[model samples]
Target: MDGLLLEILTAVGFGVLGAVLFSAIGLVSGTDETATIAPVTLLVVMLGAPPAAILTFWMAAAVSKHMTHAVPTALLGIPGDTLAIPLLQQATAMRNLGAPHIALRKMLAGAVISAFIAVPVAVLFAVILAPFGSYITAAAPWIFLIAAVLIAYFSAGRWSAVAGLVPFTLVIVALQAFTGTQDVKLAVSYFLGIAIGPLVAELFSAASPMEARRMNRSEYREMTLAPDVKGWGGYFPNPFRVLDRFQTRATAIAAAISSATFVFSPVAVTVIAGEAVGARVKHAYHRLTSVLAVRNGVTESTYIAEALIPLIAFGLPLSPVAAGPAAPLFNAPPRFTVDAASGEVNNLHNLLSVPEFLLYGLLAVALASLIAYPFAMNYARQAAVFVSRKISHEAIIGTFVGLVLVIGLWEGGLLAVFVILTVGLVGGLLYRVLGMNTGVQFMGYYAAVLSVPALMRLLT
Candidate 1:
């Protein structure tokens, strides 16, 4: 086999391994990207793994975590994290019907199928578009502006969205001015300081005797499978049955488009796109879950595609998530190199060298789905029984919060712990006061970054 083929096979194997390990972790402790996969990516990058290998591992880990997150959301009525929050209602309804296994199976199947279908298409687009990378890079400022405007408009109605632009622009200018100092460490520390500002406020509040209760309490229903379907076979939720009821090509296309466009924040795109698609289709509530499943699949695929396309074609980090994993592919300071003769930017980590990473990543998703399906199916009945007999809904929330705290500490040290608390409080306040989701906050931050050039132009 050629090197590419060998790399593909190796990546697939790694993905399968990641699937089993992450599935077990998700089953016991439901956590999302930050806690479950980000740490691993950071570690692998620190260890000096090849960019292709690191990307392969990142894809495998992501697919594994997402595939298994469905279990808790379906069986326990407890979403793994923010990403799974949108599916909570549908999962609860399925679990109440003793079809938790079937729900999980459908979700896993959808993820696997979509990953397989979407990855290659995305890779092809990235490769074919590689020649035009310079033009794309040159347009980055405009793209960011467009993205920010779109996010603002979609997040709030037209008037409120327009109102939000002022603060967003101000924040970006402030951040850029502070970080543009000549001293590197000082600049980095300043950037980190800005990142942790919310955390500081939270710690002061938490230190007070008045402990803010952040726990969510919901009723847990014990799932009982129909007597006829009791084993591994239960894992294969009749996609045909589900599709017969909810499949609309228009919905799928909408979801896919939303996923493709919103590369910076896939989960937000999935939720908004799912809602839009659901409204357009009949049986909005019933179809919402599947709409989200398709959205989730498409978003993950788009994320990989958009991030990789920019990196391989132009050597630019389009999103924070992409930046984290792709950092190793280029040497420490990733840069764009233009060919003098043709003025074409060449990303050393182009599809010619990196296609195998995506191929293997999809293979891992397939393997994970296959293995996890049977186990999840069998466990669904047991999980229902166990929860009925032993677990309390409140206890699960407590455990999840504890896990989040530990993960926060791991990611940002004491600083991260503080930041999470701040983010939660501020995030909650933003929701309560401004009626904004975390997505809006993210948009504000990115928009802030793009505001620098506009400010500079005005000053000049």
Candidate 2:
């Protein structure tokens, strides 16, 4: 009785705390989930929070951040985060139509509904996959290689993205060889590299005179504000009432599909889900709103599902989100560890059970719904105006830069920083010009570690 009470109390307390913190963070345009989320989650683990509390905190953070992330996407006509990219067209269209507020509401409503649906479904799916955990981990090397190509193909780069996997994998392999000589093995460095890659690439381009001239903006970007619209008369509105039968159904279906395919990039899954919905709806306005709702909701569902399913089922960083933003949950060493040689699972998978994940996962959505949903629904415009007018993109990037430096320095000192910079430069440039997203690059990192050696041995 006492133990159950403690767990419930812990869930509520931390869930609310995470919602508050992340909701604000999400409003900041151009914030990437991995750079912000992974480091903060690491802090939670390092501080010795209970595994259940930590899980709730992290899940709530993802949910809330994605919800508020719609603010910048809808109002500012910029991606709220990496996952917000797909919704850009839909969001911008709504913004032009003077319905940015409506876009924000539908986006949050879909998030709330799909998030609730995704939790139990993801937990059940994870439990179903749990017995095969050993086999999955054993096949991880090949799985990563296949996942790399598949994700790259689905990305905007198409065949070129798929083909680029070879050199990208080779780059990771070369870096690993160098780091091995220094007696350091790294994981987060690759993630930070990929996460910050686009920024680094843009900065590098500024060194050339012609490129700098092309990059410079002559004046402040114009702002568009739709007339503020009220929802169906409440702080918290029903998803069903706000969203038509088709929109709600589409959101639910997409969330379920996305939950199962956790290995794919969240953005890719989002794009696929959005496209699927977009295909069925013909009317431009309805299609626009429904697609935006489903896509933004996907941002929540995919992140939640990817993080939960991997931690619960395989206990390995098998999915891109799992391997990146959610890595510490599985393999933060000293406190939590995954054995490289033996394939041992000793993280939240070992720490918490399936039932626990379900309960806390739902609790996370509840907390986020209570705080982030209504807050986003009510104050999205105000928040959007504040960020666009007040915050500078440079400041946001600098904060993440400082965080990358701190965590890298702590891990392997100067060597870790070098690895992060090297990967970030190459990965970022590839991403900018070639459309090789971080998701593919993360898989490339995994393949270099797991599959390259296997391929070599088979050849031998």
Candidate 3:
């Protein structure tokens, strides 16, 4: 009773704290999930935060970030993050319509509503899948292989993305072999490389005289904000009052469907849910607003669902979100661990039960919705403009790079540094030129370790 009560208090306190931090971070344009959340959660695990607090913090941070993420998306014509990329078209349309304020409101309200709906539904679905956990673990290696191919083929790079996985996988395998011979094994280094690939590539390009010339900018980025408009009279308004019946239905249904599909790429899910909802509506203006709402709602729903379902049902990093930002929750060694040798999960699955997941998960969402929704709703214009003018993308990238370097040094000194640079440069170029994304690269990393070894054993 005492432990459970402690967890409950921890969840409430940290959930709100995470929301407050990431809510502000979300307004900054260049910060994405991998760059922002992954490193933060790693620290949470390393610092020995209890399991319940870590899970709650992860969900709360994601939900809050996605909520305020709409501020930049609608008002300043920039994507809030990877998930916000799909909402750009409709966000741009609404901006042109002189209704970025309405777009921002709808997006926030939609997120709140979908989060409420999705958390309960995702937990229920995860419980249903719980009985099959052993069976899923037995086939985890093969499932990763197939998922890698499918995600690669469906990403923006298409067939090129699929083909690129071949070389990427081989590179991972060779690196593992070399590291193992030296009695060193590194997973975080590989993940950091893939996550920061684009930034590292940009840094490299900026160092070259020829490429730096093309990258030079003469003017500061300019942004125009629509006048603030408020429909509700109170400090915090019910989301239903902000959304119409059709919009509410679309957001709910999309959230429900998205929560069930924790295995696919989140960006793909965002695009599909938006299209699924939008195609049914015919009016251009209504379609624009509703689809944008549904898409942003799907972002929170999918991230929560994807992270929670896999953690609860399988205790594995089965989803892209799980394999990335939430990976440390599943496999941070000496603190939390998922044994690669025996398919044993000794992380959150061992610490928290189903009922606890439901309880803490809801607390996280409620805390986020309570804080982020009202803040973004009230200060969308001011926050967007402030972030546009004050926040430095260079400084954010530099900070993350420094963190990565420190982690690499902690792991294996010069060897780790070499591995990080090699993977970052090669992976960044592939990602930039060939369209292969971090999600695909992550799966490729898993496939190299899991499937390749399994294949070799079978051949032998």
Each model's total of backbone clashes: 1, 1, 0
List candidate 1 segments past 4 Å from native: 1-21, 28-30, 34-36, 127-132, 156-205, 208-231, 234-354, 370-375, 380-454
lDDT: worst 10-residue window of model 2: 223-232
Give per-residue CA lDDT, model 2, range 286-352, as digits (tens).
9999998899888888898899998999887788788678877986666887664446768999888
Among residues 3 or more apart in sequence or in different chains, the pairs in candidate 3 whose N, CA or C atoms overlap within 3 Å are: none
Deviation (Å) of 401 in candidate 2: 2.7
Candidate 1 per-residue lDDT over residues 139-226, each given as its tens digit: 6555556655665555534446546656645744553454345222111122222233333344445566665554232655444333
Candidate 3 per-residue lDDT over residues 18-47, each given as its tens digit: 899999999987577976787678778778
lDDT of 1: 0.51
**Each model's TM-score?**
0.66, 0.90, 0.95
Best of the two (1, 3) by TM-score: 3
Q: Model 1, poorest ten-residue lDDT window? A: 183-192
Model 2 Cα shift for residue 141 (angstroms): 2.2
Error of 1 at 382 (Å): 5.4
What TM-score should be assigned to candidate 3?
0.95
